[model samples]
Target chain A: MCQLLGMNCATPTDINFSFRGFSQRAGITSDHSDGFGIAFFEDKACRLFVDNQSAVESPIADFIRDYPIKSRNVIAHIRKATQGKINLENSHPFVRELWGRQWIFAHNGDLHQFNPTLTGRFQPVGDTDSELAFCYLLDQLAQRFRQGHPTLQQIFDVLKEIAPKIAEHGTFNFFLSNGQALFSYATTKLHWIVREYPFKHARLIDLDMDIDFSTVTTSEDRVAVITTEPLTNNEIWQAFAPGEMILFKDGKILQQVLTTVQRLEMEKKDPSLVRKTKADPD
Target chain B: MCQLLGMNCATPTDINFSFRGFSQRAGITSDHSDGFGIAFFEDKACRLFVDNQSAVESPIADFIRDYPIKSRNVIAHIRKATQGKINLENSHPFVRELWGRQWIFAHNGDLHQFNPTLTGRFQPVGDTDSELAFCYLLDQLAQRFRQGHPTLQQIFDVLKEIAPKIAEHGTFNFFLSNGQALFSYATTKLHWIVREYPFKHARLIDLDMDIDFSTVTTSEDRVAVITTEPLTNNEIWQAFAPGEMILFKDGKILQQVLTTVQRLEMEKKDPSLVRKTKADPD
Candidate 1:
């Protein structure tokens, strides 16, 4: 078991506030104290900081908390090391370059017997099922789109086809980002919240701390935060159904999909349950 | 021009002393301060830290100085940004994964009109001639060895063929490592030194600091350092002849080669100019 955190913002935004609470789960409030990693995307490039040390005690994490790095998309993970040795190579979030864009991935749940045939284009340096799953996803993407770079929608479609298949093995809550957008799928536990205009004060559930978002943010600033567990107690966090995938871009949900199993179950209850939502026009 | 620093060690060693003086070149000692990055390799994977902020003022750099991260192979760069915009993406050293091993590269000199045909396998995230050259080299390697992973000697042979061609355009002094070994090539300026048993005191050229390596290191520890300019004032630093390439592994030179131009120049003076060296057995 691990924890995941992701942020998609309309503007370049820092994750210090959310990360402070999320990292506490690594050692203080929770027992995910194996290793931790975080990636902050600056356009197509990202600065990935990872450590085999627990985030609560890592000097890098301390620097991250002290320094504010703003990014449009960010992904972070704290590991419990279900598989793979606890080392720098096994630390999450794992990063790989695909289609000239840096892709970051982190997983929160374990997968059993999840080895997939790899074409060697994208290979995992670490021996974790999480990294293996990530590499498999990238390998499939590279094979599917052999020509030019795929658009966000095209990638989302491919992921929609692939996530459920990977989830079938076991719990498969994960976050994937390519600087432009963030895609998250949950098979077991995941939650997300959107903070936009008229932002009010929020308090951390793990620590005795609070933030007045309205004081620090402009009205145009919008941010979407996804995590295995809600970081704040005051903010309303929406839980993802057993099989749901969401694509977030510019701090808003661009598209959402349900797994075939969930869709079938929903149709059995009500035909309106299989609903599709379009992106809001900016 | 920028500054480059690299370390290859027989044992995992901390680079605090070298990095302290090397980082000073970013602002205090010299003005290659547009941005900076460093990569510390842990087996086939690495921890890459990059910042658009000058190393002299960057908090990340401060943290690096305060904390010692031990690695067997390390590559670092301080960018002056003659080719690309002064941003995070343009900062060196650049990293890309090939054959499941992370390759780290950093360049000190500028390349003029040096765009090479990319096969879409490895592409530069930023618009830098250095990164373009790196991508070009990886593309060439991927094309040459499509079947399996190439040996260190094979990669060295390929680099000998590719480095001279890229240097024809402009200065191409660079450092590259894949955790197994460190490869360096020089067009204009580069230097290296090896510290082993009977290690003596060395003083930094940039800062008024000195270290007695014999007191801190064991006899089994051997370290080879490569830099744009020698960091120490007392150590004997060997200058790389123009168009010279050297491969270092386990803190010792494994092989060395001179470009045809340099070989011809040396042969004109002495017939025994073309020489080859083999790795020393432990």
Candidate 2:
């Protein structure tokens, strides 16, 4: 098991406050102390930092806490080594280049026998099943749009088709981005919160620290945070139901889809569920 | 133009002492301060740190100087932005994965009209002649060895054949590594120094810093450093001739090759240059 943290913002913002609480799971509040990694996207470029040491003790993590690297899209992970050994190659938040842009991915759950064919250029350097899944996703995307780059909506449609299939093997909660939009899928546990105008004070769940958003943020600033578990106690964290996929861009939801599992269950309960809700067409 | 610094060691060693003086060239000493990056190889995995900020001003660089992350192979670069914008995407050393191993590269010279056909999987993320050359080199290497990875000697042979062709376009001084060995090629300025059992105190040329290798290193340890300019003033550095390529593994030279430019120049002086000296067989 691992923990994931992702952020999408309307403007470049630092995640020191959230990361402080999230890193506690590496050794303090929880036991996910195998390794840790983080990726921050600045336009089409990415800055990735990974280490085999626990985030709580790594000097790199300490530097990250002190350096406020501003980015619009960021993904981070603290690993427990469910599949691969504890090494730099097996650290989470892996990055790859696609369509002349950097893509970052991090997973929070384990999969059983989840091997996929890797016939494309994208290949995992590590032995983690999570990395293999990331490579497979990138390969499928590259296969579908072979000519050049695609729009965000087109990517969302393709990901909606593949997320459920990968989730069928076991738990599959993941966050993916390409310096453009953030796509999050939940099979077991995930939560998200949007902070915008009229921001108030918030306290961390793991640490005895608090922040007054009003003092540091402008009214035009908007931020969306997604994580395996809630980082703050006072915020309105919306829990994702099993088999739910959401696309976040510019700190707002652009699209949402119900997985095959959720759709079938909804169909069994109420045959008119389709008519009651306006599902976005793929 | 930019600057390159690389180190290959028989044992895992920290490079803080050498890096301190090398980083001074980013702004304080020479002024190649558009951006900077460094890569440290831990076995097959790599930890790459890149910033659009100058190393002299970047907080990340300050952290790197303080934290001692030991590695066997390392590459560092400070860019002067000859062809690309000063942004994170254009920072070196660039990294890509092939055959389940991470390859790192950094360049120190300009390439003029150096566009090569890129029909393979490798592509340049940033718009620079340096990165394009790197992609072309990797593409040609992949083409020659399609079934699996080749030995270090085999790679050295292929590089000897391709480096001269690229050097024809413009200056092509560069450093490349795949965590196993360090390969350095010079079309212009490059220098190297090896330190072993008979260690002595060395003084930095750019800073008021000194280090006594006898105090920290064991007699069994050996290290080879390759840089655009010598980082220390007291050490005896060997200068590479124009169009010469050297491969360093385990802190020692494994193979050396003369490019077409060097061979032609040597032939002008002595037509029987090949028979006079023993050249390693391909």
Candidate 3:
């Protein structure tokens, strides 16, 4: 299995504090040493850094830890090579250009038989199941919206419909963003926390590091951090129920839904009993 | 006008030494300091680092200068912002995926009123004339070859035909690569030098730095360096003629051509006197 980390902020924020703790899982705290990658979204632009080397050893990762790249949306992953070979192409936090904007995706779970037909438009440059899934998702989006980019809610509606089809293959926990909003879906393990105005001092679980949020952030600043495991021990990390999908924008939950997995389970018992409302309605 | 630098090698080679001198042109040496970007290709995979910040001032450039990320093909650019704003999206060394490979492009010159009709498949995320030209080229390629990727020679043939149409708009010196080969076309200033088995010492023109290539390279290694201007003072850099196109692979020139600019000029003088052969035929 791999590890995933994502951040969405009300203001442009740096991930050095969170990344330092998350990167320890690459080789130091854990053995997910195959590869690692991270992407930071600054408005409509993005910066992606990927390496086949373990994050603990990669100088790029070290640079990232020290250099504060401010962004509103970020996604990161540490790979364990479940399906693809250990190479630069298979590194996570895969990115693609869609609707004249860069979209970043990172996956953390294994997909059993997830070979979906891909159109020529968005093909996977890397031979990884994660990349294939991302391509398929984009292909579907391109097909659904043949014209210009749709609204955020329109995208959410389509994703809610398609997320279940991919999840049917196997465990499909992922985070996706297009610099505007972040969408997270999980069939198994995933956790998220929102840090708001009265941000307190926080300590990391994997590293002996502490940061006083009050000293660094203003009252208007808000942040939402999603990870496979909580990076800090003091924060209230909420774990998702199976088949839960959440959309975040400006550090707040914009929308949430029970994906196909949960909906199907409910429908199998009683088709009419499945709830039409979202899982965690705003 | 901006500055362009490209490296094609028979073996995976680091660009730190050349980049040090090349980056100096971003601010210290000259003033193409609007932004800078570089893309390194490892097989079909590519790592692109771009910043709106000047190469002399960006921490990302500092990391690149120190970290030795080896690659077979590299394209770097320092922009003077002839046609676009100084922003991350408009940074050079733009990348797009096609035929299951990452295609990297960087342009050094300006294009006036160079807007080509774009298909929805490949569109420019950044509002730059250089990016628009790149998109148009890719769109034409995608249109010409509806199946899998064509051979390098086929691509060269198509590029030869289309390059002139874009170059007619304005100055369009560029470096393009899809990991397999590097293609350079010059409508204005571009130069190249190939360092082979009998490598010699070279001194940088922009900085007080020198490298003994004989000490760092093996007999099997060969490297072709292409840039806007010669980075080293002692190297035998061959400047490209106006409207000349060169294809490089395995650190050697595979093909060369006299683009439409030269052909059109020749035809205007004498209708039946245009040559079909390459400009610098060996």
Candidate 4:
């Protein structure tokens, strides 16, 4: 199992505050520490940093924690290596260029027997199921829209249809971004929070650190943070349903779909559905 | 014009010494400092770091100089921004995936009226003549070899056919790598050096620093460095011919091609044919 973190902002915003707490899971707070990677998009292009070393010990991660890079979209992952060997190629978040735009993807959950046929447009360089899934998703997008770039709504519609099919294999929690928006889907565990105007002081749950957002942010600044676990304790974090997908843009939920309504109804009927909480080990 | 730096090694070797001097040209020694980028390849994948800030002041560049990220194939660029805006997208050392292998490219010269038709298979995210050339080159390769990966020899042959056509538009000195080998083409200015066993002390021209390579490297280590200008004063650097292309692998020149032998014959006949030297401004 791995950990995922994503941020979409109304304006360019830095992820240092959230990443400091989130990266602690790599080795300090928990042991999801085979490798780690992060991508910060500057419009249609991004700066991708990856390392096979644990985030807690990597000098690159140390630089990231100290440097404040402002980006409207950011995706990060801490890997524990369920399938692939521990190397730089296997580190997430993975990136590919599609339709002249760079797309970034990171997976947190394991998939069983998830191989899919690819048409050679997008291929995985590393031998990881997560990267294979990412390539498949991009291939599907390219196949669907063979001409010009697809609209965000069109992409969202396609993802809403594809997420459940891939989730059927096993857990399929992922964060994907194309510099314009962030699409997050979860089959088991995920949580998100939106911080907008009238931001309050928040304390991190994983580390003994706190930040007063009001002091650092303008009223126009809005940010949406999605993660496997909530980073802060004071803020209200909303957990996704068993099978839910959400699209975030400009620091707000642009669209959302419940792929597994039948599962939710079954949970409603049966109380022993076994929903994982924040205190549960991932 | 921009500046280029590349390294191809028989073993994984760090570029700290060369990079320290090359980065000084960003703002300290010379002013090719609109932005800078570098790609370090590990197998078929690479870690690409780019910054809009000058390499002299960018924190990421500072970290790269301090931390030794060893790689067999590394391509770096310091941009002067003749064609595109000074931003992360237009920064050189552009990367794209073709045939499941990551291709890294960096251009050092400007191309005028060099718009080539793209088949929508590979597109440029940034608006630059250099990126457009890269996209066009990849599109040609993908079209030429549609089924599977092409051998390095085939790719080099295709490049030999394509480089001169692009150089016809204007100056087109560039460095390209696909993890397996490095292909360098020179239209105006480029230099290279290969260091093997019995290495001696080398002194940097840009900075007051020296390194005793014999003490730090093993006998098995062989490194080939390509740059816009010679970095060391003591080492013998060979300048590329006006239209020369070289393929380097395992720290040695695997193949060399003179695309414009007619021009070389003319230059030999006419002693007045001007050539840029080490002291000439790029």
Across A1-282, the per-residue lDDT of candidate 4 in tens digits comes to: 999999999999999999999999999999988889999999998999999999899999999999999999999999886555888878888888888899999987765545578999888787777787899999999999999789999999999888787776567899999999999998889999999999999999889999999999999999999999999989899999977999999999999989862222332333332322211111
Question: DockQ (Cα-based) per candidate?
Answer: 0.59, 0.47, 0.66, 0.66
Docking class of 2: acceptable
Candidate 4 accuracy as lDDT = 0.87
- Of candidate 4 chain B, the 10-residue stretch with the lowest lDDT total is B273-282
- Name the lDDT value of residue A74 in candidate 3: 98
Which residue runs does candidate 4 get wrong by more than 4 Å?
Answer: A261-282, B261-282
Model 2 chain B: ten consecutive residues of lowest lDDT: B273-282
lDDT of 1 by residue, B1-282 (tens): 888999999999999999999999988899878888999998887999998888899888888888899899999988775544788777888888888888999987765445567788788777777787889998999999999789999999999999888776568899999899999999889999999998899999999999999999999999999998999888899999998999999999999999853322322333242213211000
lDDT for B67 in candidate 3 is 90
Instruction: Give interface RMSD for all predictions.
Output: 0.9, 1.5, 0.8, 0.8
Task: Output the TM-score of candidate 3.
Answer: 0.93
C-alpha lDDT of residue B90 in model 3: 86
Per-residue lDDT of candidate 4, residues B1-282 (tens digit): 789999999999999999999999999999988889999998887999999888999898999999999899999999776544777888878898888888999988766545577898888788787888899999999999999799999999999999998886668899989999999999999999999998889999999999999999999999999999999999899999999999999999999999962222332333332322211111
DockQ of 3: 0.66
Model 4 CAPRI rating: medium
Off by over 4 Å in 1: A261-282, B261-282
Each model's C-alpha lDDT?
0.85, 0.85, 0.87, 0.87
Give one digit per residue, the lDDT tens place, for model 2 in B1-282. 888999999999999999999999989999988889999999989999999888899888888888898899999998787554788878889888777788999887765545577764677777777777788888898888887679999999999999988776567899999999999999899999999988899999999999999999998789999999999999999999998999999898888877875323332433332223221100
* TM-score on alpha carbons, each prediction: 0.92, 0.91, 0.93, 0.92
Question: What value of lDDT does candidate 3 attain over all alpha carbons?
Answer: 0.87
True-vs-predicted CA distance for residue B170, candidate 1, Å: 1.1
